[model samples]
Target: MSAATSPPVSPSAVTSAGRLAWLDALRGIGALAVVAEHMLPWFVPSLRPYWFSLGVYGILVFFLVSGYIIPASLERHGDVRAFWISRFFRLYPLYLVVIAVVLALSWWVPVREAVVRDGSAVAAHATMLLDVVGIGGVADTMWTLSYEMVFYLVVTALYLTRGHERSGTWAIVFAVAAVLVGLVASGAVFGGGWPAYVSCAVFVLGLTGVLVGRLRTFSACALGVMAVACLLLSSRVPWLGTAVLAVMFAGTAIYRWERGTGPLWPVAVTGALVVIAPVWAIESGWWWVQADVWLTTILLAAATFAGGMALRGRRLPRILVWFGLISYSLYLVHHPLLRYFVRVSGDLRGEPLAYQLVMTAAALVVIIAVSAVTYRFVEKPMQDLGRRISRRCRGGPQGGGEVRVPGESTGDDRVLRHEERQVPHRVSDDVDQGESVG
Candidate 1:
């Protein structure tokens, strides 16, 4: 195959046409779960107590999918500059659109004027590091982007340090660290003090190290330390943040094992740690009330991820795949849509269950329809534009027949095997192609 159209060498990597259907299916399911999690409880108040935080479950699945794929993308290309470029184009365009929508809505809805004026909103938009910078997400659902950005930085550091091979070990280490950090630094250690400043500074230093490609080992260590600190000290809920990251790395470990780059025992151990971390680290006020549901979320997420792996080669419904294709748009757009729905519908909390269900169905339809349009008009065009620019910079053909990047679009990747030429993970588009970075 030409460079413009080559197969992803490993089963863990995803591409546009060569994507594993099961993963698309998984992402689609997760997207729906997120929507249900946010909107369902609003309409059916009775289900609030019973639901195990569908949003958490959905976003966790997304994070795992990301971890499984992103490092591989960086390694396959071995070009940090290209990786960053790809990420910027794939993520920022849609993000800006969402921010624009939110701003437009602010005319009527009560937005925090202080946040917009105090430079916090600008910082959040520019870096997607709002959570680490001591500001909450501009959008309620956008907080995960902060963690996702940190993950990308951490992976870049690992790739630079040549420590990418020990993904499984790191997963286990992070899981253990989560527990330890929870015990000693349960609350925010750097809410707004020198500790916070130091944390952000070290993070910047680590990113600089990755970019410079000098003292890579030291850079990786610094980034690793910063990642742990951010998770433990900078996050609003340190334990939960740590647990989520542990789960993501566990997914990475499993990907490594599946690709035959690591032994199975490490993945097995990491999986166990992932399962246990939430139980140990989650600071549920009513553990008795929350534990079972939390455990259920963990188990369900694991099962969903495992199911995706098992059915990697199976054919799935096109509609389901379509949902996955639009998953990123759905994730970013649904929040605003939900808010709009509530605004127009007035208080549905006291409405009849049947009426509320109908409204929810209507809302889902609108969300899906808008998401589809965005995926077509916004996502695909920008992805193409990014590829065109990249290909031009690389002095390659710009024609759209088969222009490709490692984890972006590729030729039909029918062969799934252990190749030394592992495919790169495209952090921009998420999982493989057509996946969200969630």
Candidate 2:
């Protein structure tokens, strides 16, 4: 928090708490939102207004979480190669497996036209480009990933170069300028235009402060201000996506300054408002009320972040952590899955409504089964494997809370279990071998 602290390793900060569990709970919450959003039509008319559109907020939470975590992972390893190797193992394999399964399901399932059309726009989604020029667009609540991957790549690069402190500032300026230019060029910045580029830039631009050896007061204040401003104006901001992206960037800044003191009350207050500005727009009576919403959102994110810090050492259920671990994959695949089930259920026609209900249950089971499979068989194992490989190749601590580019500890996180073992078994002979393969 002050100096170059280590990465945050516990699912949360508290040693007594199940840090990972909290994250899993958040992810599970998000996943449910996605499922309910997709199942809108199946529910009775009175209940079908897409109650879970708020899941998009959950996706934004994921991005904020990523902004907090990815840099920590990279900082732990102290090398770009190892950082990338870890990322490859962490995301790609599971993503490929999930996407492949979704693609396969199209044949047997009766997906909706819009669902499939939207899904198709994101052929590059697994690559994390939901904002791209539409091989497939961000149809399945997956648009957040483009920023996640971009953040991973850029933050790792910056941290490794030890220029995170300096470059972060410049990146933000440039990225914002890009958004403004796109606006000037087209006379509109939203609607998939230049602002989207800026929205995409949030992830990349955030890397600047990620490598910070210490969190700063001013930066925190500035981030809090900008995020609130973005929210207050969300209605005018085209798709509201830019504000989502800004929060991701702002979240990183807030974390950079929070410095593990647990969240400061003031920062936490502002954070909350920023996270929920969109709600203010929908619920408030006047445009000025929306401005108040901005402050409220800023208050929310800062407070929750602080809350996350305070809750760090508290104990939570293991089941919760397990769910948190596979959240990203679940988030990515849930929409298509729900759509596929709807398609298949429609064909059954026993009772159109009845089939929808039965298949909805089936869809839940399938998502859980698939996420469990991915976590056990793919995500965790590969993460362990990749960390081992990275440690062996780089010859440094491999399983700490944060990857230290300087190969030292700032104490942000504990060493993961396997990381604590001297020379994990897989790393000894496999580092070079894995490097080559990677």
Candidate 3:
């Protein structure tokens, strides 16, 4: 039942030219796959494939997409404050709305047992670090946000340290850790409600420092360390957590390789290690983690991503691009809506096959419609506000120019030009977008 999704790219990074439309296509594919994964069981049990998990496939695609674009978005702006601002606005509005909807409907659909059991849902949701801190998300899909937040913190710290470009190395390191840790470790080492509280405090203070520009490096480092520590010692599954980071970093490594800033070996090595990370995992009992299924899912996700990259220069279907525009809202809202639908309608599993298909189609239409509305109303306006605020901050006296990392040089101009050429094809709204599980 464990599944996750990625967040959308910052508004500032998006452009009217629809650059990165391939990514939007990928996000569209991932989003629908995840929704179908969640929906098939309820609507058409017979159609739910057991060979390879659609949810995992979607999540891996999202993680790869996130890995590839998040660092690029941050680097493209070269302003930590702007990056954080954009991310916050892009992700939080819809996220909070989902949480609120879930809570409001709790009378009809009880809160997830895990959330009620943990008693730290407030702290966990507030920090969006639910899984790593041993708390369930208010909505089932929220678990992925924990890892997304971790990646952001780690990337921010690396940016400050001028080590952000060493993506390939980090990918290798984490991939190795996944295999090593899966052999022995499973579940949180720091068990309790306390990690959530402490981490939340640190998260707030660290982010405050980062925004205020006082002790920014120290604060970012602290947040990064806390993020890694939580992933290693406090996650529900240490190896899987590590593996997720490896996948994301692998995405970053791929981005580096494409930009000519790094080599390709790490990408291959990371992919191999991740493919095998869960094969021998002592803690993994899920059917999807079985060697054959896991490998197929991994390879399929890799292929899907490669296909998107290969098609990056072409004009993606407008329907897919539109789906990408509302991906985040769809990802966040669909789960709760599904739960509510099930609660109200009761089990439809015993319905006739045709009836089930009809109901499923109806549900999808509703979900997509609602998602689009939220995207237009909530996500879009908030993102626009974030972009304006970022621009204003950058225009202020204290607003600075692009940050120059220690190892970068004039050669970056060529890379920037290369990126600019590619930017027009990218999906402006959905850049660095994450997917969610069913």
Candidate 4:
């Protein structure tokens, strides 16, 4: 999954699609990693390795991608209203579809026990803060959306304050907080259903103010504060939530560095801190969070992002970009479809290795096919609608025009012209901007 607007392209850029093909490539790889992480356990248990977590690696890549692009998206538009509109349409249409599918299949698959135990599925899911507020997602992958939402709220606030460029400083701050919180805090201070309700109310009120432009700054700040508080006080693991934010900001820091506006040291420092954050954390009992495995996963994810950045000027393989195009659908739809497959075919862990491998391949084919369809009919249309609505809100014609802000790069301006020619009325092409989870 990814959560960033597509980077601007220059008219002379060699990429075929007028979009960042490397980012799409990264998203595609991350999505496949997550899919394999989930599918292997049930389909080919022996192939599932425990040396490092595929799921964690995939999601970290997603967070980095989101961090790198989301700020750029908001800044390029220079309008919180348009930014949120693009974000909502990009994320929610498929998200709601997944939720509805899960509920409709509940009689066959049954909702996760954690969701029932938390007893605030509606409220938590509505806010996409389910994990931090102690609720389980209808789909296991949905836990990641909580952190994504938090990042979005905080990023929006920072954009409103014109402090969004300080990505490196924010990354370091969150990294330090993660270590300190790990040392002192053990579990959620605000547990149970009430926090969900309160947080949901705050989310609603804050988002309403942001969209409506009434006391917008205060509302954005309040939402930011609330988001941070929830991450520290109400998450399943405070240190992890804090560290995830650090990772995301570190990504933004890298983006700034690339654009010649930020230092690179904070990215290094934040990465170091995040790597060690869970080493001594009381809440971190999972094997993957142990020093060795965690370090490997973090480094690999970082390297992957760096590799993508290095290749940004080149044309990536079209298959990878296509995968990235449907990556969001792949991320949201794969797990439930896998569950339904299990319900129909029964667990194949006991099957022969060849048979299991064949089945897994078949399942992957189905998932990719379904994801492509959903992206075509569901995600793309909603995104185009969002762009049109955003243009109307900005008092622009719902057709073709370039939006030039004072500080925007000349390269971006050229890219905007190219985009207008190729994809008229498009604000962004990267719609699958969220983390992939297992």
- Candidate 2 wrongly placed segments (more than 4 Å): 1-14, 17-20, 41-45, 48-52, 105-126, 137-139, 161-242, 260-307, 347-359, 396-407, 410-438
Report lDDT (CA) for all predictions: 0.66, 0.45, 0.79, 0.79
Number of colliding residue pairs in each model: 3, 56, 18, 5
Give one digit per residue, the lDDT tens place, for model 3 in 175-230: 99999878777557898899998999999999998887888889999999999999
Per-model TM against the reference: 0.81, 0.62, 0.90, 0.90
Q: Give lDDT: candidate 3, residue 131.
A: 95
lDDT of 4: 0.79
Task: Give candidate 3's root-mean-square deviation (CA, Å).
Answer: 6.5
C-alpha RMSD (angstroms) for model 2: 9.4
Write the candidate numbers in order of decreasing lDDT.
4, 3, 1, 2
Looking at candidate 2, the ten consecutive residues that score lowest on lDDT are 429-438
Q: Which lDDT tens digits does candidate 4 get at residues 203-253?
A: 999998888887788999999998998999999888899999999999889
Tens digit of per-residue lDDT, candidate 1, span 1-438: 654566445654433332455666777888888877788767877666454668878887888887877776565545554565567677878888888888898876645432445444564546676565556554667778878877777776666556777887877787777666656664676665344446556656765554444654576578666665666677766666766677777777887778666766765665565555544345546442276766777778888888878766556677776677788888889878888888889889999989988988898899999998987888778876775564454343322112233343234333322221342222234432323453
